[model samples]
Target: MNHEFSIESRQFNLWYGDFQALFDIDIGIRQGIITALIGPSGCGKTTLLRSVNRINERLGYVRTEGLMKVMQKNILDSDVELAQLRKQVGMVFQRPNPLPLSIRDNILFAHKLHTQSHEKLSRQDENNLVENVLRQVLLWDSVKERLHQKAIDLSLEEQQKLCIARLLPVKPSILLMDEPCSALDPKGTEAVEELLWELRGQYTILIVTHNMAQARRVSDESIFMLMGKLMEHAPTDQMFVTPACKETADYIEGRYG
Candidate 1:
């Protein structure tokens, strides 16, 4: 476990009931940079992403082999706490899914849940947190006056921004995003990409995206998967300009998904 990597998988395999979705996944996701997972639909990109936070295990029949580690600790151990794992590994889904609560409350929800009652923050501290996170996601000015409004009422872009904002108060070290921009329009996608750039070097970002252009533009490294197997992993530019494998080249060139 090199300190330079935030997440590592060794011989990782996963199955949903009798259907295997991932095979021999060995990866070392570098710290403090964005890594994009790209492949066609049903290639196990999302499955790999969800495994980072153990989200795939929600299905009772799902089973896994090998280790998935974060910060050098294997999270597959029976004693590992789901609550704590999720706190350190925040996830953003394909669509914005803000809680049906006030905007302020939504920002405060995770902080409040993770903090012990005796360690609760003062009202002023909570206010500062909400403001800081919103500003981090570039949403402060637009919704500053609407803190009490229901989060669901925000525009789709704002709602997605808020979803990302709400994760900050907990100080997550890794963010696992599954097609985070898929539901957004072009303008919204651009805004979110800007936010991703702003967030770079502060957290380890692993994003699953079908958009090759977006992956090339936003990620420092790119990972290509095919039929539940890792095909290539390299610097984004190198992978795009000179893929080492024919499968990788074919997928990038749009010859095949």
Candidate 2:
């Protein structure tokens, strides 16, 4: 029951009907640090992130085994509410998917859903909340004057930042990012990477990325996975310099994924 790590997966296994996606994944993701999950396609990087938020269960045939805990709660428990879990663990997808609403509304959307219904969050309170989160994601200055604009109208980088901003008002402890910068150009990628640094130590971030350089730049710790199995987990510097496993070394050297 201890919240030992921001997220803990002990002997976790996952399957899609007859096909297995993950095999006995055991990892202790330290609190408030960025951990990168790097692997080739179909290596279950995204599957692991989705599992923390129970997004995999949306599929009828999906089944899981072993313990997967987020903030000390076993999310696989039948009694756990998806909404409550999601409130504690937010996810940013590979693409920015803002609702078809104004920038302000996009930021306010989750706060409204999770807050007590009877409590009237004053207009000022809502405005403050929006501004605070926007600032957290480093988007306040650029979009501050365009709060009423539709989120879709913004540049891809801005929309991605807004997606991250929206998650903050919910007070999430864990942030799961699945290749969050894949859609951005070089400049946009750099901007978001800086924002990720800004967010470090404030929230536990688990990012799945194909870009090895990006992972090395943003993550304090690195986890290498291959063919649905964990190859190695180590400090970012050690992982890059002296990988413990041959598979890891191969992957690091740009060999077969």
Candidate 3:
């Protein structure tokens, strides 16, 4: 267990029924930095990301071996509570999936869920919380006047920003994003990338992105995976400019996935 690492995997292996998706994955994701997971389709980037919060177990058929740790605790332990674990780890899906509720309510949803039943915030405090998180995501000015409107009404970009905003009230130490800009246009992608830069150093962000340009633009560190194996992990510039592995070089040079 390394203090500098927010997430660490020790010989981690995962399987969907009989088919293994991850093979002896051993990596340490440093704390409070943005790391990008890159690979072609079916290379298990998402699987590895989902494993941090144990979302893979939702399928029931998913089984895992080896250790996956977040904040130095092994979440696979039976005593670990998913609800509390989720508080420390937040996820942004490939597509925006904001709750079908008001923007204000959406931001408050997770906070309320994690709050003790007896612990309650006054309406004013709630408003402050909403404003604070929305501002953090750089969305408050745009959505401030429409807090009561349904979140679904926002454009894809706003919806995605709101989705990211909602996760903040819980104060998650790690954010797992699976190609969060995949559903957005170029402008939207740029906006989200800027927001990610704003969020750097505040949280440990692990993003899975197929877009090579986006990976290079935003990540401090880059990880290259192939066939469910970690091929290379290096500084973003180093990996792009001078990849260590032959396979990594090949992949970056427009070779076969």
Report the Cα lDDT for candidate 1.
0.95
lDDT (0-100) at residue 29 of candidate 2?
Answer: 93
Cα error, residue 49 of model 1, in Å, equals 0.3
Worst 10 residues of 1 by lDDT: 54-63
**CA lDDT of each candidate?**
0.95, 0.93, 0.95
Query: Estimated TM-score per prediction?
Result: 0.99, 0.98, 0.99
Pairs in clash, predicted candidate 3: none
Q: lDDT by residue for model 1 over 1-257, one digit each (tens)? A: 68899999999999989999999999999999999999988999999999999998887888999999999989999999999999999999999999999999999999999999999899999999999999999999999999999999999999999999999999999999998899999999999999999999999999999999999999999999999999999999999999999999989999987
Which stretches of model 3 miss by more than 4 angstroms?
none
RMSD of 1: 0.6
Question: 2 or 3: which has the higher TM-score?
Answer: 3
What TM value does model 2 have? 0.98
Candidate 3 structure, TM-score to reference:
0.99
Q: Stretches of candidate 1 above 4 Å error?
A: none
